[model samples]
Target: MNQHVASGGTAEAIAALVSRFGDRALTGLSVRDLHAHDESHHPASRPDIVVFPNSTEEVAEIAAIANRYRVPIVPFGAGSGLEGGAIPVAGGISLDTSRLDRILDIRPDDMIVRVEAGVRRQEMNRQLRDTGLFFPVDPGADASIGGMVSTGASGTNAVRFGVMRENVLGLTVVTADGRIVRTGSLARKSSSGYDLTRLFVGSEGTLGIVTEVILRLHPIPDAVSAIAGFQTLAGAVSAVIDIKRAGLSIGRVELLDEALVAVINRHETLALAPLPTLFFEFHGNPESIATLSDVIAAIVADHGGTPLRWAKNADEARRIWETRRVGLGWAKAERPGAQSWPTDVCVPLSSLADAVLDTHADIRASQIPAYIVGHVGDGNFHCVFMSDPDDAQEQAEVHRLAGRIVVRALAVGGTATGEHGVGLGKRAFQEAEHGAEAVALMRTLKVALDPLNILNPGKILPELADPEHSN
Candidate 1:
């Protein structure tokens, strides 16, 4: 196996890690650089070795090797994660889990599916299509289930089916010292001990590497529809709160700010009105569908929304959603020099409109190219700020804007991060967001599980979470 010759001790440790897998291991491959970084704004640091394991046994073996060698080992999925979750900043071994892609079991009767970590969310959905069951946690990146689980990701659908943390029934994870542990149960509820499953779900691979995942599936709804509510964003936000209070079961609710609408109009070559909009999907029978839409539409009008349009078929629905799924990228295209700084915040239903309006003023005052999109029914939205990462001043200003927004969210009893886990990028703000006590607790758990700090070092929680706890 080829390994990095420089960096002396770390290279040697990585080399020793490779030795455990014999010639089957790979080292110093240029592919390691590809595996080293993720889609974050952070700089990439290539791992000394990259291992693609086909089975959970191999994952355990690699983790064991890394543990023995005292080298940092980073587990990765599709590498589409926005935070620095998959990036190996402390260079050592990168355990690429993509090769483990497999559907191990599908218990349709129980509405659960057991699959290897690397299976993509869309792939699982495709396989389950004919089974009248669907796993609905979509991150809009065709992200792997492993990556999704790692970051505790949720997309536009989170307003309904919930995020990965709720959807995951159980998991087979390889802990820091390389012991395989399974948490949770297949049955609906469990008074389980410690709830390690949740502990690992959003841990971002700091505590353990998930090898397999059991996900809950919802039955296919009788109808799929998308309705666009045209309004000033404030109106759209108000309408959603009203609709939800009326006890309507909205499958999905999305908000696209005027900035996003303009960008999508140009990028997708669709002449949509350059106004804030809300998209809705309703489940259940045709009668219930009509009733909900009419009620929601009337509320939309009452809130000063106008020109509402519902998708005519699946094709139209796909077009509308495809745009929302990739709207961040499209918004960045508006400014040639800008990239995306995505901040996920969820506020209370009563305060959603104020949060959005404040975000608008923040963008204007910052004088930055930005767009906003939300899964509104749940009061969560993303402000995609287009920024110049190489410019120190610009980066600082972007982060400053983000901090203010996060502070506002927290002030209103919301969270700094709703779906995106507190990866390396969010470490500095964890104390402010979660309070010092909660952060200390997270640190204690980290030290308890990964005593040596060999797994995904410098990620999620700050430092080694006390570092002196015995394994």
Candidate 2:
């Protein structure tokens, strides 16, 4: 009834997992060594057992078994996360939620949809295409909606549409002690007690295992216009602030650092200036769209940024946008078998240019071949560094580099993580970023919901921060 580390590389402990979940759970699971980590430089640590649960009831049953043994349970999504959220650090049970892939209902009138935890963002988007509605919160990877909501996911669209916390309507969760509870409702507004959905949405699966999610959807844009251009780093960021100030109903506003742009050019097979860029997408009626584009172009030109360059037509727009959609994965595939350290730090809107320029300066000094990308309209950015985990020095450098960036973000009144939730990677910054009082409240909530600390332990909250010392 205690957490087990992956000390034994033998099958004896693995037999225990097979004994409970049957051969199907044990047979043909991902390579055990591979399962030991997420998409980060976190050293690989295997779970004592891995169980695949196919439904909410099955998840509850699995939870009961895990509780009986008092083994730690780490819920996993697509493993595309940079924060190591899905890594089973305590070596107990890596509960796989990929099998619960079902879309329960699409309430067009209410503009909401209910889905199982295993549903991927792009997969759900495919299903919603026909209804002229789509889920807007995409976290780069086709991350599972359940996982997205679990980590309060956000991405390019977040600048306009908000994150998972703003989009999710309700959740069906299995508590640590094997209790089934449905939180929140389909209603748009709830003066309900505690606002439970928001709590679990960004809880990083520490409170409970979310089995199902009800999410708000947006009407498919009547037309999407994407414009990509290169500019000096300072100019690109300034242009983004200007666009927001002008009140453009933009759908996606992104910035790619010059170093990152070169990678995109090589990996994505496109040629452009090797300078920081601002990618813009406007969604609205034709009249507003034209006027807004003109306003945005003039602003960019004023700041020495490139003029708006778009696809000649809608078909070309889709093609151009598709390139950006797969940008992260494309970059990942560039270096085979390497893990990416994605740093997401968001600064105050007014100080965005300063924050970005400072971070860029740091990146330039680092040895890591890093690429910077962001949902810049919101002053949130990601610098993805590809590195081999086996390389000790490189990994250590990444850790230090990432840590400095976090400190910088906190200095600017920003967070350690902007969109990607605090998983294993950001745990070190817990005290430095959030003060003593705030962190204590978080710990109190964690204890209240998951008394045994069985649900995704060792994430978000630091191991044991001296509240008063705050480090």
Candidate 3:
């Protein structure tokens, strides 16, 4: 649609892929529709064909064929992305990576694992259960490793373990021209020539399609999780700042506003008090964890929070974390038939209280059924707006409200997107968040890596600026 493909070239490319992949290359409407859009509120756009490659070689071949025909290649993972990163807006080839599932190698000694793009986070952790080490970058969605890498995803554990960018040590990428290139290394640190791994880590499959990832793993430490309720959301946020300032080794720190806690209680069938709450997980040896818990308990008390309630056992801890994981789902259940516009923004630690409070105020004023939940440890938070799908005015208002949130974060020295990459949903804010020149440079890099504009086009960057025309 955007000249990424030649007239009738998509059909030819599909024919070529089908010939190579047999039944794995699907043209059925249902599959196309499934790959059309992600979890975002963006409108769906089905791909002309969905190709599943079982190996990096096959992925390279798909790229080669797509490049030859000028067909756009949209690499799709689990489609759990909040932004429209996996959406095939140009509708050419949706290169679904599910068939490439493989845990190629696990160096338990090195605390690293190499996996194909299709391996899900939970599945990887399950495999690592016996190893005493686990992949810690949990984006909560059981998202595929490739999708997590593409979106630069992070979750509750990110405050301690870091995001995809830091955890991902190496990658096997199939570039736009179908070249198989390996970036980064197994070694922990390097003064390498170019950090291509990072470039592709959050490129959202625009620069290239990631086929395999080598991820850093962490030893499963003795974890103790607790919940603290507060009278106001601001108090909970302030407690988070104090916990961080105290230099506590907090594994996970989350904040759920009173409304969201109520939703979680009703949906999860838990009778926890419907109050602004802070959920925390501390990791260390048992003695250290005990001391850390005591320190945290005192900090929360100082900030007007309820006494910390420790999870009695692992099952209780799982349930506590699970509640945070399925927050979006429970929110949807809270208001049946309402669509959710899940948006997130991260601010500096000092601005966390103001950001959460101001955003909560915005939600109350809008009169929209929205809930606030965030991984507040790193000053990142999400507001899930549940609006009637048929209510066009409500949809527009939510979009504007989300924009204001992003603007607020940017003003306070924060990112437009904390983890969800600059997919279609956040494209408009790129320039506002990073200046026009920086965005233009991003375009130049995109063009240099993907000259044909055939790799996940119309994503990340709102519009492609002609490098030759740029100053």
Candidate maximizing lDDT:
3
**Candidate topping TM-score:** 3
Q: In model 2, where is the ten-residue run with the lowest total lDDT?
A: 1-10
Q: How close is each model in CA RMSD to the real structure?
A: 3.5, 3.7, 2.0
Cα lDDT listed for each candidate: 0.80, 0.77, 0.88
Report how far residue 439 has shifted in candidate 1, in Å.
1.4
Between candidates 2 and 3, the one scoring higher on TM-score is: 3
lDDT of 3 by residue, 1-471 (tens): 232333448778988998998999999999999999898888899999999888999999999999999888999999999988999988899999888889999999998999999999898899999999999998878799999999999988899999999999999999999999999999987888899999999999989999999999899888888899998888899999888888998999988889888877777655677799888898888888876777888889888999988999999999998888777687887777898888889899899889988899999999789999899998899998999888899988998999999999999999888888888888888888889999888978987988888898878886545433221
lDDT of 3 at 209: 93
RMSD of 1: 3.5
Ranking 1 against 3 by TM-score, winner: 3
Error of 3 at 460 (Å): 0.4
Q: What lDDT does candidate 1 reach at residue 384?
A: 84
For model 3 the TM-score comes to 0.96
- Give the per-residue lDDT of model 1 (tens digit) for 287-384: 87877777777887898887467777888877877777777776776678677888888888888899999999889787778888888888898898
Instruction: Give per-model TM-scores.
Output: 0.94, 0.91, 0.96
lDDT by residue (1-471, candidate 2, tens digit) is 122221333254345557756853543436445557876666677766667887888788767766666667788877777778888776677777788899999888899999999889898999988998999987767788878987888988898889888888899999988888898999987998988888898887788999999999999886666555655788888877877888878788888777666767886545656777777778888887877777877888898877677656787777666767777667777778777888889888877778777777877887767778888888888878887767889888887887877888898799888878888778878888888888888888887877666777667887653333211
In candidate 3, which residue ranges exceed 4 Å CA deviation? 1-8, 464-471
